[model samples]
Target: MHKSIMIQGTMSNVGKSLLTAGLCRVFKQDGYKVAPFKSQNMALNSYITEEGLEMGRAQVMQAEACGIKPSVYMNPILLKPTTDVGSQVIVNGEVIGNMKAVEYFRYKKTLIPDIMKAYEKLTDEYDIVVLEGAGSPAEINLKQEDIVNMGLARMTKSPVLLVGDIDRGGVFAQLAGTLMLLTEEEKAIVKATVINKFRGDKEILKPGLTMLEDICSKPVAGVIPYVYLDIDDEDSLSERFVRRKEGGLVQIAVIRLPRISNFTDFNALESIEEVNLSYVTSPAQLQEADMVIIPGTKSTMSDLLWMRQNGLEAAIKKLADKGKIVMGICGGYQMLGDTLTDPYGVEASGSLAGMGLLPMDTVFEKEKVRTQVTGQVTSPVGHFKLLEGAAIEGYEIHMGTSSSKSGGISSFSRLEYGLAGKREVKQDGYIMDNILGTYVHGIFDSEEFLEGMVKTLLKSKGLNYEQVKTVDVKAHKEEQYDRLADTIRQNLDIEFIYKILEAGV
Candidate 1:
């Protein structure tokens, strides 16, 4: 039998995603095959799966914790918010079109079967499935057609663990009031209550915890401490200005464009103790950094225009000419070429001049290139010839293809590119000294690639360098989750939770 647990928050940003990931890791470590599930998630931060479908990055992070490849099934319903009140709804990995709040609420009930289908598929494959609920379940106004919170719990007949943010204050009111508002059926599904993001000593809150349990008639599961794990957050709430640690170190500036798409590319760098990462919006801020990185953008042409409007275009040129290392990924890679031609107006407007740093041009194609690639770099960079035979693996999701005049370096080829009598190099990928651009996402995860870039930066500074290795990220994440699970196990009413799990709703 596939046992599952649902983690629901009393409010948004109450550590629902992190708790789900922790549970996934915990179950996996307990010798159970586990999978993460979210019926619906609304976030601008998305990740392209190997199947070329877009899903919330939170599920991808949770899947990583379980040591599994992320799949579209993990997040069956993704709502990419286009505005404050509207979102582009994706159903079963395909876009169904944009809808306003009311329209989605009225239409969401029709998707229950779809949600069930996806959930069943996951349960059939895994020994345990950890379901994550979005926002608060006590929002009675949305309960009519809700499929993400208590409604989903009712559908799966899974035991629910209500989590409240003690760090946000009003822990007692948030827990007590939420329980008072829940329907009796919905309330019964909640087997245990969790107090998350507690900062100080747990003993001090004993009376409060007892009072909360007495009022709600539910067992207090755990009071989890606030953990700052270096994982990718998939919502706007967690996406904020991360302060640069105070230290004299190598400074790298990333242009925080208005439409920056893949900012998660820099998460690994942020964790490096010797590197300082800053997101700059103005051209003046670019002068204080040792290296400038133009991150990926969803709308390349518009962001290029944004750069030109803000005078950052000239600033980047000056930085490049001064022998500063400049890197771009995906859409940012497309912007580094000679010109960007969108004659078909696929992305936006018309053709425009690119930064012209490399002898290359990018053309927007109707068909997007999305794939998981594995290869090694074969380019000459001073005496090191960085990444000559180093194995690198990452995914590519873009609609533009690049080409160079003197022939491009071999990276990896798609089956279509190969069978069409075309080489991967000709499909628009380029690399040169101190400048590298590619359409592949998540390439920085490769230690070989990061070390190579670090070496190049050190060389540019005329300083001797030795590659400094950090912790293995995958192992580190698993260990973090293990710690979280241990904490939960020690504090929660495990017997009561197990009894609820055993008794189906």
Candidate 2:
């Protein structure tokens, strides 16, 4: 039998994901096979598995901490929000359909069987499973059909650790009030409480911790200090968008679309020491950028209209006309074309004018393209020629196909996909002058592609590329995982956690 423990937060972004990942790493280092599980996740940031199935990035990150391959079973149900009220609901890595907030709430209960099936598969394979809960469980209105929090703990027979954010203040009230709100049966499932994101002295907060334990009648397992580690974030609530870094050899600006999905694609580029990346919301921030990247979005047409209304479309066109490097990926790639037609109303009902930087047209389709690809850079012209012949690999997740408006143009890359024993080769994206676009999401993750891009940008600016050192993103992430595990081992009570897992509720 597999032992289980769950981490539930007092509110969203309270370090629940990080703590769960840390526990996963601790268990792995202790010579036990481990896996991460989440019943349902609602986030725009997603990842494509090796099987070409989609799942949330948080579980992906936790799976990495466990030194395991990411699987759709890690995140059984993923909800990618397309608007304020409606979301694209995906079950077991395939799109079921779009649903409104109320509609999904009524329909989510029916997915319990699917969730259990996935969970049982992981339990059968691993010695330990670290589960994560979304949002707060204190919302009385949402507690009825809650398959992700106390309800999941009940279903899985897992012990719970309630986490409260001390950095946001009211840690005691958050933990105490949450327990007060839960039913007696639900409260029994919680074995301990955790205070996360704490700064300053722990001795000063000892009195409050003791009082909190008394009030909640649960042991205080840990008070984790605020530590900075470069890890993937969950969703739009990520602080990476608002942060600004000064002084770098190269400046890259990414357009911050309202419905941006998979912005984590740029994380590898941001890890470079000589590259300063900023998420720009307006034209003013794009002035000094050496390259402007339009990122992926959930709603291509609506976000493109937003760019048009805010004058970013005109500003990007002006930059491209001036011979500045402009690149687009996925939905951003769709926006660089001449026109976008959605006869099936996948995004919107009519045709919309694009930025017209590249000579291509896009048409949204009902079926989404999801796959993992490997390829090499094809023939190129101008400054981008530096990337020619470079090996590249990434995954594709989009709802439309783009093609040349006038016959055909030079492709940005030649892609190959493996199926059974045969290999299928196809061309992807288009390149024109200083503008290029591709549907590949993690195009820069490969060292050859990233180094080539940096060298190209540097050569364009009349600088020596050898002056800047390239980062090995894979090794850097491994170091970060170890650092996170070290912190958790030092601050949290691992022995107590083991006891909780063994004792259960």
Candidate 3:
């Protein structure tokens, strides 16, 4: 018999994704075949599966914790926001169309069938399905048509462990108020309340915990202490974008665009002991960097314009002219080109001049390319000759096609395999002068490519690459999952959680 439990947060960024992932690890460690499920996810950080399908990175992370291959069924619906009030809606890993906030809200309920189809697949295959909720079920306005929170819990018949952020304060109010807002039936689905990110002595907070339990009429599952784990965060709320990490041999400044998507691509670099990776939105931050990276974005044209208006484009161009290493990935790669033309209004209508750092020009098309590819560096290039012949593996998810204007630029990688078993060998990206650009999202995730790039960067600075310790990101992530499982086992009521899972709503 398959059992399930849901983790719903009192608010966004209240550690919902991590908690779900931790639980997945715990269940997997306990010898249960587990998988994560989120009926809907609204985040720009997405991943492409081996089947050439897209899903939220949070689900991908949780799937990793479960030691399972990520599937689109894990996240049936993904909303990639393109504007303040609009988003590109992806259903079952394919883009349906862009929808405004009101339009999506009205049309969301209609996708319930799709959500259930995905959920049933997981239930049939796994012993335990760890479901995650988006935001809070307390949003009374959205509760009526809600398909992600209480509604999803009811649909899947999964008991919930509602989590509150104690570190953010108002742990009592957050937990109690959320319970207060839920209908009696909805409240019944909540098996227990979890106080997440708790610091200070639990003994000192025992009285308050008792009071919270008394008021909410629910068990305090646990007070999870704030853990410092190097996990991939879901969205912009990531502390990685703001936290300062001191002391490193190399400094890489990533241009933080307004709609930065898949910034998690750089987490591998952060794992290296000698590398200091920082997200920079200003010109001042770029001054002392050994390398600058332009990451993927949901709005390429608009973000490029934002950089142009904010002087970041000028600063990066100035750095490039001085022979400094500059790199671009996906949308960032498109921005590095000479021009960006949007004929179908995929991003925005009309053509916009790019950063003019590369000889390529990108034109937005109606079709989005989503595929997994493996390749190797092409011709050896100046400064980064160390990257020559390095193996690379990643995925491409973009709505544009880029080509060299003069056809004089050298190719970066010779990629093999495309969407749906299409056996095609094609050159991807470019390597020219001091610039590098690629549509591959996880370009640095390949340890071979990553180590080679790091060595090249250190070599350019006259530093010994052999002296520095590089990270095996894949192995490191497994260690982190174990660490997270240990932490959860120590703090959370795992026995009770298992009972809750078995008890089914």
Candidate 4:
């Protein structure tokens, strides 16, 4: 008796993904085995599952909320947008080829059986399945062939809970307009409407809520207040990165590029009480920080160009010249080198000059290097020493290999799955002393390495340090899931949701 509910947004960035995760956590706390499902997701941010399959980072985050390893079945179809009108279609974690918007719309309907199969598999194993819908079901132009929203609801006969963002304003119209456009059958499946991201007093929304229920004949489930939980957002509209408070202790500036990826790497740092984290957008902003970090990027060349355009290139050069500590991860690591040669046109507009902080070069290859590795740091840097022989684990998802001539630098350490052998060190790759660049994402998850870096940076500034340690990363995340679940449970209509799941409407 697996009960399910689908949370669909009135529009994109309406907090559907977060809501889905919250519901999954809530149901799980209520003694129900719960999982999250999405029929299709489109984003460049992706994760490689344990089975070596790829899926959207949204479902990956949702899966994290459920305290489970991510699976390709959780997100059966993923579209990584490569161009304005086309995307690289990944079906069941394998690339099928690039397809235009119109082509994908027509092709998506054919995959319904596969989606249903995955859904059925989850239903059999879990007591509850919370499905998240992408974008909106009110796109009348695209409704005829929709498979992500109303169409998926019809397919599973699942009750729908439409969520609207009140913080963005005109939420009433957003919900009212969407309901007005829904087909009779589509409208019938919607059991309740929940207003999300509401700030200020909930009493002020009473009239608006009454009007919405009167017009749509749907009950107002709850008005979710804005909760500033320190969690990762799956998409580009990540408020977690931007909503950070200023700390009076160690100041670290993160260069906010136009196409920043893997920005979630800084979440652990944000949790530290003694660290002040800010996203530096201008050269003037860079001058106030003790250390600077360049995060990963989707298009290294394009982001590099953007850096130059914003005068950040000059700022980075000045910071390095002043002997300030700087670090780069993945594409950010690629950008810290002398030159990046993309002779194969792998990352847009050919080769380009790097920030030149390290004497290394990166060459983009046709194939991507994807793997999960656990190892120790062998470099002379104190941060590396702290991480020496310390069990470290993270995944690598990139399309290039780095080479450096600097002695005492490990080309690749701790080879694990997807890494067949030791990586060769050339005249150019990973360099040490005042700089560290690696293709590994999630490196900050290593407690010894992260805390040490923060302490070292603080000590470099002649400032007193405080040791802040995170207990069990996995447990901390599960606790977050429980908190999110509690929030939804306290606000939403639990009886109605249970009835919908029981009735299979």
Best candidate according to lDDT = 3
Those runs of model 3 whose alpha carbons end farther than 4 Å from true positions after fitting are 419-421
lDDT of 2 by residue, 250-356 (tens): 89999999999999899888888778999998989989988999999999999999999998988888888888899999999999999999999898889999988
TM-scores for the candidates:
0.88, 0.98, 0.98, 0.92
Provide the global lDDT of candidate 1 against the true structure: 0.78
RMSD (Cα, Å) of model 2: 1.2
Candidate 4 structure lDDT: 0.79
- Residue 336 lDDT in candidate 2: 95
Segments of candidate 4 deviating more than 4 angstroms? 99-103, 382-387, 406-415, 419-429
Candidate 4: C-alpha RMSD after superposition: 3.0
lDDT of 4 by residue, 1-505 (tens): 7778999999998989889999887776677888899999987777777666778878888888887778888899988766678887888888787789889877888898889998898889888889989899999899998888999988877899999999899999999999999989988999889999988987877988998999989999998888877667777677765665765477788888766776777777877777788887899988777778888876788888888998998988787778787888888888998889897777674678888888888889877766665565554353344434444566777778887755333442443555346533222126466777777677777776677777777677777655555445656677787788788888887877888788877
List CA RMSD, all candidates. Answer: 3.6, 1.2, 1.1, 3.0
Collision count of model 1: 2
lDDT of 3 by residue, 352-392 (tens): 99999888899899999998889999875777898888989
* C-alpha lDDT of residue 389 in model 3: 89
When summed lDDT is taken over every stretch of 10 residues in candidate 3, the lowest stretch is 405-414
Q: lDDT values of the candidates?
A: 0.78, 0.91, 0.92, 0.79
